[model samples]
Target: MDAMTPPDREAPAEAPIEALLRRRWSPRSFQDRPVPDAALASLLEAARWAPSCFNAQPWHLIVARRERETEAHAALAACLSGNNRRWAPQAPVLMLAVARTTFPQDGSPNRHAGYDTGAAMAQMAAQAVVLGLQIHQMGGFDPHRAREAFAIPDGFEPYAAIAIGYPGPADALPEDLRAREQAPRQRRAVADFAFFGGWRA
Candidate 1:
């Protein structure tokens, strides 16, 4: 992953914090514009700072820009399904988040690698919203293909790939996507998904 930082250096503040948490929502349509380099950098920077188990810092990012990095983008996006393909192209950038199991000390498996990486991704996604950007996580990619394409060695596992860009008009999206554009976020109620203490009887 290209670790590029934006020139405008300002530590992330509260607005982004709330936006990241509340305003963030996945959308199919994306404005056909290249996300500012600084914005991308800021997002990654936030991700890099996320806390990890044993400070493993296992998250790995692979970024693909539309024009400048077509080969990598295509290889990454090729793993997705047709649903994502419909409007994913409009996003200026695509990212693949990966993790390495070994921490270079012992050969033991790092159980927290995937979890830590997920934390980092959450940080990045939230920060992106603060920056007026949006992201969608996709699980439809081919792992074996991603491993070969990215030349990921034996120790590392590709966790997930994300589509990143500015939000676009829902109308511009295809009928299927457009239909769900204004749909509210669906979730099991807090009571359903959460438990007060011990496992439910």
Candidate 2:
């Protein structure tokens, strides 16, 4: 581990779960290191295997490696919201996750497109952990600007902007974000959301 690397912020799971799942977390601070091409491909490969409704496979990623795709990376950075733009640009890689709103088999609306796309990104996040990397998916972005910048087709919708790289020390981030980076991870109890047989209010 590098001297600048932060300690693992593992989740305190109520039940046993995959070690990777426990280790996975989104960090705003990233080291100024390039992610290898092979590792990026592995992340996409993991996403490719995610199951989608009717096998539509609507998820698509527009990748921009800061050192490799300098112009594109800057353009993508411009699409982020002010808050995210602060730290996200520091990441070595940036990506825009988009989803096709219609099925390829038929030009009909696919309500699950966004849901399926999310699943794919989830897989990518796990794979990042495996590669000693982390991804922070941000909804705080200008979708309209992204669409214009990328010339995204009408049938596709920009879902999220992703920042990918090795985690860095919390102190690397701005004071506010540094606090969040060092904060303990929290989640709602399983009983709060899981209803065995019926909905509970």
Quick one: best TM-score, which candidate? 2
lDDT by residue (1-201, candidate 1, tens digit) is 221122211223433444236666676778888888898889899999999877878888899998889999888878776687777766789888899887856767899999999999888877887777878887767779899998998989898878898777777977878877766555555577567986664
Which residue pairs show collisions in model 2?
none
Q: List the residue pairs that clash in candidate 1.
A: none
Q: What does the lDDT come to for candidate 2?
A: 0.91
Residue 104, candidate 2: C-alpha displacement in angstroms: 0.4
178 Cα displacement, candidate 1 (Å): 1.1
Give the per-residue lDDT digits (tens) of candidate 2, residues 1-201.
122224548887889998788888989989889999999999999999999999999999999999889998999999999789899999999999999999999899999999999999999988888888999999999999999999999999999999999998888888998888888889988999999999996
